[model samples]
Target: MSMRTYVTWAEMITGFARSGDSVSARRFFDQVPTELKNVVTWTVMVDGYCSNGQMEMAREVFEAMPRRNFFVWSSMICGYCKIGDVEEAKAIFDRIPVRNLVNWNSMIAGYAQNGFCQEALKAFGNMQAQGFEPDEFTVVSVLSACAQSGLLDVGKDIHNMLSHKRIKLNQIVLNALVDMYAKCGDLINARLIFEEMTERNSACWNAMISSMAVHGQCKEALELFCRMEKSNEKPDEITFLSVLSACAHGGLVDEGMEVFSKMQKKYGLEAGIKHYGCLVDLLGRAGRLREAYALVKSMPMKPNDMVWGAMLGACRIYMDMEITEQVAEDISTLNSSIQSGNNSHYVLLSNIYAASDRWEKAERTRIEMENEGFQKIPAHSAFMPCGA
Candidate 1:
């Protein structure tokens, strides 16, 4: 290889950056002659750092760059957003002297991914106001925000806009539409869009099936899963998750067991903790507390709060003080390892202890809960029968 044909510094930097070896990427950047350094080189390094989650280092490189381009600025925004720092991403987005499609898309995605659905919708409106059209990515992100936030009208408008503009619906876009409608409690529209899709992916099927399951249409959800299996498209773990959830919700214990076996025996996918949690919940609901407890004890991995919580709920069902105490202890151990809503577990355990004639222990548990700044939430009940 002649020196004349040496790979350009830009190419080397980009390769290293993309490969996630920020250390090597930075070293290559350092060796480049200062005068030889261009915007591409700087952007590549910053992008590498950001992609590898070295946000602070990315900022350092970004600040030191003599000149910055749209990509560099946009990448920084994306990096902050990727790390769930939407506020900072938004601030940078606002400062861009000349915003482009990429910048707007990043901001919209950031807000949507971080659960700032209202902000995402507002950004979408702003993008349109600035004469920028929504591409598939933009459409998907906005649709997701709408789906999660229950902005059904906005989601429908987006669907209508695609039709009016004669935009082609790809698999991902179609999946998003289906998901949005389903999650917004518009299963009829979801089914309509799903039927219209010329092409479908597992996500599209899973979304519709999950929608059915969510709405207590487990039988129909199972039918869809069977249809998917009949086709060439293989069910992924997420697909099985929906299937199992449907079985659990419908109280189809035998079916849930069969599907659970198929997930590993036929599909060759290992059961994750989430699947076990669902199974335990199903058993708990079916009054199979002993089986649920045995399953939890036999788990290959450490049971999380959700799994123990399910068993605890089962103990509450059976009113087995000894087993309830054991599950309560596991939940207490999980409280230190997982950061989630453990108040229900604590309260249930306290109540169980009190009911089981363990008054002193119940008081101690209540005191521990108070030390953790939790109070017994007052139970309230009412019936509107109709929607409020």
Candidate 2:
């Protein structure tokens, strides 16, 4: 085939791969002459397989290649990372003969995304030690690690470094920065960074709103939601979840109902299970147990354990034995695995019984829980420093 035809075939391969049709891409790939296949062509095939979750096939083609490009290596790392196979990604990273910023960033992001915050931080330190300057992507990944681990000091160090280096904070990096500060309990810094942003997207708005809501600054969270609307950024499902959470926390029953209505009617978004749970919690907290139960019954989707758990929580708070019994029965009807995993529901029901001076029922509930193989898993906390 002519060079032009080969280019067309390569483009077709990419097009197929991008459309999640890796089989077609492989058909075109196999048609290419061995001598005419370049590094770009090889990389595309590997990437296509990886993109389609055909990692074994990707590795097969990768191994068969007479030569490897850095892009191919990065694709392998990214593919493994996408599958939560970070150990294999690290193995690929360790094999890279000449490491670049992309390689380091990929490894760091893989670790961070997979909840290996400590490993991500160690990789960040190592990257810097090797005289590589972190770009926006690097900063964002490192900040995510710091946020996940609540490494406030390390987050501060990265923020200071950004100032010293004068790196132009792109929206992604700024959003990550805001998220890091907010998650680390530095709401003051979080708000400051948020205000400094000249352009705000949904993610930035969601981060700030969620942070405030989680920290019991319900009024402020609502205020920020208002600002988000005024700015014309469409509030997605995540935004509404945060808004509903704020209402629940603040006991803003009327306001929460209005927001919940607006989520479906005005915004044309469906109220997900979590959204329903938040609204249930909102009403349940305000001692509107009957209304909350009615709402749960009216939901189009079957209420999950979370939704039922929220109802049980309110029952526990108000000592409503009737609703507690109903919610507990509803929970028992769910999939056995879900029921077994959430012993908190059983515990809450038993507590409500005990609180209402029904000792026999509480003991019976405990015995039932034990018979169902529900063990109350001990809660634990870990203080994982970013530098670790």
Candidate 3:
């Protein structure tokens, strides 16, 4: 092939790498002889492996690169950070001879995305100290980290900082701020931000409604759904999911049914499994186990584990031994391994039988949990770290 042919092939190979197809990238890279295997070509291979989550392979490629540039080093840092290895990513970041804004932003985003909230906040602080003014990317990632780790004080501080910096409040930033406040149990301030936003999109409305739903303001969430319906922004299936979830939590059975009906009939939105699960939860909360079961049976798509789990939970709450047995048997048949491993179903079933003085059945359930090797999780758990 001529030099022009090599350039065209190089572009094609790099395109594969850029899109995370390392297998194909390597295959194409092998076609190039040693003489034409430029630094850019090798760096693309490194990026490809990194994007595909093969950090070791990325490292190998990086080491082999005769001339590594900023992009090559930064991609490795990002890969390490992407996989929750912040210490390694930071090591690479420290070695960058002359880091630019993109490099800084990548580090901040990496820490935040991997649940290293404090590290992300520290990076933001460090960036400002180095005389680099934060753009929208920096602020947004920090806001998300604050939201994830429930750093309410830190989140509030960031909000204040954004205001202090006179940053234009984009719709996404507003949504993130609203989500942070809601997650922090500060609905009053979340609502204030929502109401103050100049423009609202589907995502923004969904966030506000979801926040209200999660924070026990179910009625307010439904009201926001109504407001979304009336506005120019059309409520998608997710909007209905949020609304249905609100009704389920609040025990608005009638309202839940109406919304479920209208979502299909009026808005032309098809109910997904999550929507069905939420409706099941709504019915179950209202002490309508049979109705919930009928609805589950009526679903076009087979109800998933969550839908069955909801039914099992409901049967437990109502202390319906017969229904619990029936549902438990159904669940065991459909997803035996999953139901066996899940403590919620087993514990709830055992307690239901125990409440009715069926001590033998309850004991058997506990024994089953032991036999199935699901007693390892210790019955209750939280995924977050201490101090987040």
Candidate 4:
């Protein structure tokens, strides 16, 4: 084939890869002449495989390459990272003769994705020591790692670096920064960034709303949701979930109901299991046990453990033993049928029995839990600074 024909084939392969048609891309690759399979062609093919979740195929292509460059190396490592193979990705990183900024970013991102926050931080330090200037992707990955690990000091250092480097804070990076601060429980700094951002996307709004909701700032979350609507940005499923969660947490029963209804009517988005759970929790918390049970029954799909647990919690709070028994029996039946590993349902049921002064029933429930090897996992807490 002529050079023009080769270029045309290469473009076709790239398009197929981008569209996630890896099978077609592979077929196209099979037709390419050995001489025409350049770095770009191979990289695109490998990326296609990786993006399509065929990491094993991606590795085969990576190994078959006669010569490897930084992009190829980074692509393969990123494939491993994407599939949660962090150890293999790190092993590749250690062996690369010419590691670049992209290589470091890919590895750090993998570590962060796998919750190895300390290793991600250590990798970032090592990248800087090796004279590779961290880019926006690098900063985002490290900030996320710091957020998950609750490394306030390290998060602050990264924020300062962003300012020092004069990196333009785009929506993605800004949202990550806000999320880091929010996760670290520094609402002050989180709000500061929210205020300074002249442009906010759905993700930014969602992050802020979630931060407020999780921290019991229901009023603020609702106010922000209103402001978000006023700005003409549409709320997606994530946005509604955050607002509903805020309402559930703050006991904003009326607000929660209004939002839930609006989600279906205005946005035309069907209520998923998460939204249903929030609504049930909101009603149950407000002593509307029957309403909550009615909502659960009305759901098109069978209620999950979370929905049942929410009802049980409400019953426990109101000491409604009559309803508690019904909900507990439903939960027990569902638990037996689905075999979901959530022990919280059993614990909640037992707690309800104990709270209602039904000693024999509570002891029987405890015995049942023990026989099934169900144990209550202790809750753990951590503290991190809001911003570095």
Name the lDDT of candidate 1.
Answer: 0.84
TM-score for all models, in order of appearance: 0.88, 0.86, 0.81, 0.85
Candidate achieving the largest TM-score: 1
lDDT of 1 by residue, 1-388 (tens): 2241124887888788888888888898898876667888888889898888789999999988888899988899989989988888888888888988988988999999999999999999989999998888899899999989888999999999997767668888899999999999999999998998777788999999998999899999999999998977899989988998898788889988998999899989999999999899888888888888899989999887778777877777677887886786776666742377457667667666666667687777767777777755423112112342
- lDDT against the true structure, per candidate, is 0.84, 0.87, 0.82, 0.84
Which residue pairs in candidate 2 collide? none
Question: Comparing 2 and 3 by lDDT, which wins?
Answer: 2
254-332 per-residue lDDT for model 2 (tens digits) = 9999999998999999988899999999999999999999999898888877787788889978888887887777666
Q: Alpha carbon lDDT of residue 382, candidate 1?
A: 23
- Which residues of candidate 1, in runs, are more than 4 Å off? 1-7, 316-320, 333-344, 351-362, 370-388
Full-model lDDT, candidate 3: 0.82
Give the higher-TM-score candidate: 1 or 3: 1
| Candidate 3: worst-modelled 10 consecutive residues by lDDT | 377-386
What's model 4's lDDT at 20?
86
What is the Cα-based TM-score of model 2?
0.86
By TM-score, how accurate is candidate 1?
Answer: 0.88
lDDT of 4 at 31: 85
